[model samples]
Target: METRPLDVLNRGRDKRIVIILKNEKEITGKLQAFDIHLNMWLSDAEVSDSEVTKKYGKLLVRGDNIVCASPE
Candidate 1:
């Protein structure tokens, strides 16, 4: 069987994940949903940079803004 990136993400559902955006923002949260475009929905989300951290109950991240994602 071939292993794919999305496959890895699928397996990571309901787990904590960290997303790095093109703008250099980092977000950490629980994975709730995602799509082929890499657009994602996250719960208990936190967005952070060198200066500050903000929290949200839910977050929608556009695929185009995402540089990478990994387990937290």
Candidate 2:
């Protein structure tokens, strides 16, 4: 059987993903949801101890803003 690249990445709910934001910041969080447009919602982010906490409930990351995403 041939495996697709997305298949490897698409581990589904609660999967950990490392997102690199456009502001040059990196966040590692659980995959919360995904829209039809492929927009991702990440929650319970594991950030640095010294990092300032975000005011938002969930991080709203644009697809284009993502530098790279990998399993954590």
Please tell me which predicted candidate would have the highest lDDT against the true structure: 1
Report the Cα lDDT for candidate 1. Answer: 0.93
What is the per-residue lDDT of model 2 for residues 1-72, given as tens digits with 9 covering 90 to 100? 437544545666678787666677777778887654446787876543346644344765667666667765
Once superposed on the true structure, which residue ranges of model 2 sit more than 4 Å away at CA? 1-3, 35-38, 46-57
Task: Give lDDT tens digits, candidate 1, residues 1-72.
Answer: 637778888888999999999999999999999999999999999999999999999999999899999974
Kindly report the root-mean-square deviation of model 2 from the true structure over all alpha carbons: 3.5
Prediction 2 global C-alpha lDDT: 0.65
**Candidate 2, run of 10 with poorest lDDT:** 47-56
lDDT of each: 0.93, 0.65
**Candidate 1 clash figure, as a count:** 0
